[model samples]
Structure formats: structure tokens, C-alpha cells
Target: SQRVMETMAEDGTLPRNAVRIFWSSPGYSHCCFTSQNNLDPKLAAEIESAFLSVTDEDPIGKAVLEGEACRSFVPGTDIGWEMIEKAAEAEGLI
Candidate 1:
């Protein structure tokens, strides 16, 4: 979950700029997310499918697939009041 960790470090949640797909070890792949916000469901599903298709039998691939699935289910920030607060905080308009 290095991507997730990185995203969290940059922004408090895993949002559009937080998640990414890349090769971790040889044929194995890794998907990391530092935040989950404003994620498109269709795109998420496609990414999930891609992760699942990796032929490498490495644990990193499995972990990436599981992480993708978990992230895919997360509702974007649009549905919550917390995002409003965050927005206000960002604009210094709170």
C-alpha cells in the first residue's frame, strides 16, 4: 500500500491523485493509494480487473487486487459533509 501511504502523506485521503498502477516485482504488479476521493466507479472497476489479470503469482499482485477491490467500493467525497469542511479549510473560508 505504498501508493496509499504516499497519498495519505500528500493529502489526508486517497483521492484521484493518490492511486496508481505500477510494476512492483518483475511480472507482479502493485497498486497503491494514499487516499480515496472523487474516484470514478467505472475506472476503478477497470483498474480492479487489470489488477486481477496479472499472471504473476506473487503476493504483491494479490495484495494489489485486494486493495483495488477495497478502494473501488469507497464512495467518493461528494457524499459526505466532511468534504465540505475540508474544502472550507482549504480555502481558509471556514
Candidate 2:
């Protein structure tokens, strides 16, 4: 995935300051479009769309999205680990 992102960056498929990535923990992660602050909304949208399009087609990104989907919407998930969930909830509230 990193290699794909690097290649895209090299090829100008994605802007250099496109995103700020964060991993919340326990396999969850997210991307923030920092480009929005520097670029217009349309340009930011395009960059995000391009990134998403490439990632959606990439195997690793597909797997990550699948895992996120399962954890979020599927029944009987490991999401019920209350200790971690409570921490996440608490932090969000703060």
C-alpha cells in the first residue's frame, strides 16, 4: 500500500500534501484531507477521489475497507471489547 501511494505520488496521481493518516488502534485507521486547507474544495475532492479510487482498487485497501465494514456493520464482531470501546468513547467525548 505504501509503495502504491509512493508510486502515485511520483506519477502525480496524488498531491504531495494530500492527506494526514492516523491509526486509531486495533487495526482501525483513517485519512484526513489536509489538502482542503491549501486547495479549493473541488481540487481537494478530486485528490481524495483519486486516492480513494486507487486504494479501492488496491488489494490492501480493499481488505482494510472490508475489515472496517465488518467491524462497523456486521453482527458478532470483536467490537464489543468494552474496555477499548469505552476508552475510544471517552476520548471522543473529550
Say which candidate scores most in TM-score: 2
lDDT of every model, 2 decimals = 0.54, 0.54
**Candidate 2 on 1-94: residue-level lDDT in tens?**
5545676889999887686445334543342224324578787667656555544456777786665543222112344457865887989942
Cα RMSD for candidates in order: 15.2, 15.2
Residue 1 in model 2: shift from native, Å?
17
Model 2 root mean square deviation, Cα atoms: 15.2
The TM-score measured for candidate 1 stands at: 0.25
Candidate 1's residue-wise lDDT over 40-87, tens digit each? 878877776664465326676656646564423222223335775799
Clashing pairs in 2: none
Give me the candidate number with maximum lDDT. Answer: 2
